[model samples]
Target: MAALCPNDFKPIGWLCRKKRYSLKWKLCISMIFVLMTSMWINPKLLMSMLTPVSEYKKQDITPVKNSKHLMVSAFKDHRINGSTRIISILNRGQLQPLFCIFCCGKNNYSTPATIDMHSDHFGFRYVTTDVLCRNKPKSNAMYVTLSLKPDVLYNLTDFLPIQNQIQEEEAFPYEFTICISSLFGSYNNVLQFVQTMEVYKLLGIQRVVIYNTSCGPDLEKVLHYYSEEGILEIVQWPIDQFLIPSRGWNFKEHGGDIHYYGQLTTLNECIYRNMYKSRYVLLNDIDEIIMPYQHANLHLLLEDLQQEHPNVGVFIIENHIFPKTQFDNSGQFNRTEWKKVPGINILEHVYREPDRKNVFNPTKILANPRQVVQTSVHSVLKNYGQTFRVPPDVCRIVHVRVPLQSNLTKEQLFVDKKLWEFEKPLLPNVDNVFKKTGFLN
Candidate 1:
């Protein structure tokens, strides 16, 4: 070997003293080396480390829930998880995606499934979970909230989400109960309201559940009297403050926040509320009555119907429009006391508009509350048993309202005097209610 200089046998890349590099360059090289070593050691770990960055770059990691931290469904294969009951879509905003969550005991559901809902004209979607509880041992209750934003946590029972209990055999005081929804914003039709209630009573209904949003002071007094007497159950339905509910059933034409003032939700809720309690539930508007022509009362009609159709859970009563224009010409009896009332005396409106050919007549229902899963304005949306449309001869809806169709001649209309049978008792009953509510001084 030759005599060694100060830098003899130095590396080709090194300088006389030592190789120099900027701190940034050194750090970069070191990071690259570490990354390569890490990838070599475990490629999955490296990919995992980079995944967040990749997701961030794509901006796809949006949290599932919003800031309100409402409850949302979690995916889990719980062996004992049950079904959902009365699953109506709560609300779907333009910014938030719709959610179908579990809010009942695990025994309620038969199988795990996703519910689908579509929008009305305004693009509002609705979906509800459907399944009866199994009521098996070891089943637990669960609640889920559908938050508008992603990845937000809501308190349990914050919204009092659906809770499907085991359907116990509860003894309901009423053999027949009526459910009416969203009576909002100081509404008053005293005559019609009294007439409807009297008719319901005459038809053997023992209880009426009204989800009252707001009512006229006079109507409130009547409602209060009914409430105190235990004839009516009033649910405080202040839906306007919470939501922009729709005024009409058809969302496009009416353009409301909810459909017909959240009637569907309330109807579903009423079915569940009276599920085990009442033997049957009658769904109709205050102006409509499911008038039985052949049978003396609904109890008898239902008894005969049950005997004929053993498995039928729903009885759909056809709607007949009794235009307010028609009045009883026969001077058999005068509603002398009711003359001062604001609404048409139902007794006087006997003529019904003829059913147009190929037209969809809106219907009302007499349903076994236990078997009803979902409902709409006209008919049962879902049920546990068969649904049968009762013939017009046996029974039909005595819907007293303005004529839906135009250009009807007197000859075209037919007289439906079915409501007359109950008139004698109904008149007295109305007078008594008015007297009791202090409507008639």
Candidate 2:
């Protein structure tokens, strides 16, 4: 048995045990090879198990600040007719949703606008008005904010609706400019013009904007004189050259191209025309004046009012209609020299009709050009800052027009002495303007 099994050194049971141990080692090696292949295929799955959930989340959501280079080049507040438009530029071409957040009173709502594609990196984009109502919006003192990105937001500087209505192209350098709309060739009120302008000068007004359509020969002379003086900015408003403008503001009755010879357009244009040049704008007719009762000039009056109510941008001055029917009997200022001038002497019309019950006294405004957006003949249509009803005591509109209400007599009308306070300078100033313009000669 020893000679036959000389090649084999171990017994049968020992050989069988060695073979079984060898099989166990082979199984272990095969399992390790399968595991190595699985690990190579799904390495992230193993890492996920090892890493914490919060850390993974933090790494995933890393916000890119100021990544969206959205810009606003031009903006307009069309709230006068319940519309707002924003012109912007977007650098990135991705389809990112943008929102224009309007902050007004307690309401903060966002309206979506588009960023259109263009050839240039700085493309021109537009955002139209999202108005829900036919009438004016709930608040006038409003501002704009832009939001789209997760980390970046743009808060525009506090701009009033007035500033948004037009482009600041024709700006002037005057403290105050009176915007007299639609001077439709009427030179019938020379005396009224003289008085109104004189009072304006006393009130610290530096310039007057007249949208002239036509005028009397003599009136043209005065206008030319004022124009040469660099005090009057005359805009040759040839509305008839373009459209059949309305004869009056009543479009429903006397319909035309625009109401009252494009009066609305003229007023809006005047505001934009003098937006940068003038600090304050007084919107009224040539017959009207925002007269201060307690203070001497507009500067003092505004200083006091602004100090008290700092946030108010538009001051709605109440229009006190001093009917041309009533004349001062005391003979304070002689108007015999102005008889040939062909206009009413405002100095004589000291009697104002008493405000009747349920009757609204038409109002005018002395507004901050930067604060106002849209203006009507009587009042401000839209504004950026708060509007305030100026107290009658502080200042009010001296509207020397024909009586709107009937059955009001001398006794019924109240005599306001505010005009008399400026008589010292007003009298000489009127004469000087007349003489300087060659009306007195």
Candidate 3:
């Protein structure tokens, strides 16, 4: 036979030269060749060899997923292995790392079905296709397995304005009132408290009514001044607050009048007369300050709160001991010290308002504001009084009394203990009230 050079390539010559097989290689090669040739020659044999890839996997692979059924002739007759190859994508780092496996295009079908292959391990099976997306063609025809679940993702939307508007329209029905006694001066310790309370207007408390039992003419003048200023409301009772206990009536904790329930007669009267006008009534001393950062007014705050529980919305705020530094009055023991407590803005004004600094509580809305009430520990009674929850949002009961140099609260005890307990304490500049009420006359 004439020697044929490589340039005379009839494919077989080049194949024989390049793929020179040893005996063992030829043996395996002969087997594969015989298998390929014999199967191609007999149509029935080829059909038998080309069973569904799913059958090889002991499952059924559809036209999209079956490897054996994939015709690489869909290529330019340049045949390649038709099975799918799994490529793993880099994981941003999680337990079951994500992958970027690839396979031929014609084989890949539904994304969920492909994911099932990795999760179910139904064995490798794929189809023939060009790995293309849009008009951009992949340099190599391949299928890539992207992360089924990615750590980060984005969405297109516009859905929060509706939620905001709904919240705005629903805000209403706020009602709260503050109750106190002594106007200003008689029980000087509470002067700081009165100042602190001025901040309550920002918290929904619009009106504060003072019930006076035993204030001197000076106190009346002070109250009258505030009343004219449109800030204070005064209700006068001619008797001393202390005489109630001797009359077999004790409004405070010390003296219990069996004839009348343990509650203060005045407080009981106040409840009956004003409960309807206000959704909330605060039973506090002039030395006590109720603090809340919820709303600009107590009325509006209660309305928001009423949305929480179906019943029972009264809240009892615990007392916080204020700092002694707040009471420092430059060594002055006169009524001026009691008049102001100095706010963050003014060092001279003892009655200056403090800055808001407490945390808010998560609140449940009450169904009925009328259902709430509060009682003193001294008031021996059943818990059945209409009650409400004091959400942390509006929670505060600062008893700025006792242990201060101002002899204000302690001085009152000597006057008439029962009276002091039943009625609220006084503000400091109450003498100004006397000048206004003409009580001195």
Clashes of each: 24, 8, 52
Per-residue lDDT tens digits for candidate 3, residues 1-441, read 444546533355335344454799879988999988876776556643454322322211111221112111111101112222221111111223232222333332222212211121111112111221111233243323223333211110100010001111123333556666233224333234334444454455666676654454443445555677876666664323222222232324334222122113233333323434555566555555565445544555555655664454455554443333343345333444333322121112232222235744212222222332223222212233344546433654444333333433422322111112212232223333333445322
Write down the lDDT of every candidate, Cα atoms only: 0.65, 0.64, 0.35
lDDT of 1 by residue, 174-272 (tens): 799888866876787888888888888777889999988788877888888888988899877665654566676666777755676667666766777
Q: Which is better, 1 or 3, measured by lDDT?
A: 1
Top TM-score: which candidate number? 1
TM-scores for all candidates?
A: 0.71, 0.61, 0.37
Error of 2 at 49 (Å): 73
Candidate achieving the largest lDDT: 1
- Candidate 3, residue 253: how far the Cα is off, in Å: 10
RMSD of 1: 14.9
Question: What digit string (tens of lDDT, one per residue) describes model 2 on residues 1-441?
Answer: 322233324347424222234788989999888867876996664554454332332210111224333222123434336344332323333446655555454454556654433222111121111212121355452444445632322222322232344444356468788898867756557888878887788889999999888888777877887789888988776656644666765556776544576555566556655667788888888778888988879989989989998999888888888998878889776567777777788888888887766977778878887777656666666668898998888888888888986578798789876777778888888888788877787
* Local lDDT at 389 for model 2: 91
- Which pairs in model 2 have colliding backbones? 160-384, 161-384, 162-372, 162-373, 172-277, 185-214, 185-215, 244-257
Q: Cα miss at 71, model 2 (Å)? A: 26
Candidate 1 vs. true structure, TM-score: 0.71
